[model samples]
Target: MLEMYRSYLAACNERAWDTIAEFLHPSVLVNGIPRTREQYVDDIRKTIAVFPDYAWQLRHVVQQPPWLAVHLHATGTRHQDFLGAPGDLSPVETDEFAMYRIADGRIAELWGTADNARLRLSTHNETR
Candidate 1:
């Protein structure tokens, strides 16, 4: 299961948006919010657009039946404003923690947390 999860991350890095169904359930929820597969791909695209050269460095992975928790560090340079909403094109190194609930051998739900305020504050000076 861990290996599958890693492959999913690698696929995201490759921007293989079309292959997501191989890993995720159709009713997947991100942080408890319902998301369609298209929305998931869009979210991945946004992350890729903002951090074009980022790497998902894994810190730890622990798996118990039906659940996997991953601690990761997403470090990279920001190439553009993020979210197409509000963000800065400044360097960023954020720690992200995620938990996946697995069902029927696919990811059923995901709850992820990442630190963003530090990045925002780091770029605040540049924008000012």
Candidate 2:
């Protein structure tokens, strides 16, 4: 399961949407967002476009039967527009975590949250 998670992050950083598809269940739910495989691919593309060098640093991993939770620190620079926000050279870092539910050896669902305050501080120079 850790290997799968590592591969998933690699695929995400490399913007390999096709490769990412292999690790996800056909109907994967990310956070509260239910997405089809194509939708997932689209979201990944948009993310990579926004943060060209996005990378994740694994902090810890915990496993329970049928579930895996990962604590990660993600860092990147904005290089392209995203969700109407223009790119900036300022580096952004956020502590994020995700809990994945595995079914049949594939990721069936993910619930994730990130340090939005830190991200906004680093990127937009705003505090929340």
Candidate 3:
């Protein structure tokens, strides 16, 4: 299971959404928001479109039967306009955490949160 998580993260870092299909169920929930497989992939795709170098580095993981909690440090550089701001901004880094329910060796559902305030601050600082 841990290996699965690692594989998933590696795929995510590479922006290889197709490779991630093996790790995610067809129907997954992210932060209680139901998302189809395509939708989930598109969400990340949109993010990468704004920050071409977006990456997530795992900080920690806690495994309890049927559940895996993850802590990660997310980093990216603004390469295009996003959230009303222009591109070429400084790099962005934020803390992110998620709890995922594993079913049949795939990620069935997840609830995750990121330090949005800090992310916004990065943008604010970059603009000034």
Encode model 3's per-residue lDDT on 27-128: one tens digit a residue: 999888888888888988988888788899999999996999999999888778666656766678788999989999999998988875555446446553
Highest TM-score: give the candidate number.
3
Number of clashing residue pairs in every model? 0, 0, 0
CA shift of 27, model 3, Å: 0.4
Best model per lDDT: 3
In candidate 2, what are the lDDT values of residues 1-128, reduced to their tens digit? 88888888888777788898888889989887888878888876776676778788889999995899999998888776544545666678888888999888788898988875564435557554
lDDT of 1 at 12: 72
Ranking by TM-score: 3, 2, 1
Best-to-worst ranking by lDDT = 3, 2, 1
What candidate 3 gets wrong by more than 4 Å, as runs, is 123-128
lDDT of candidate 3 at residue 88, scale 0 to 100: 62
The candidate with the higher lDDT, 2 or 3, is: 3
Candidate 2 CA-lDDT value: 0.79
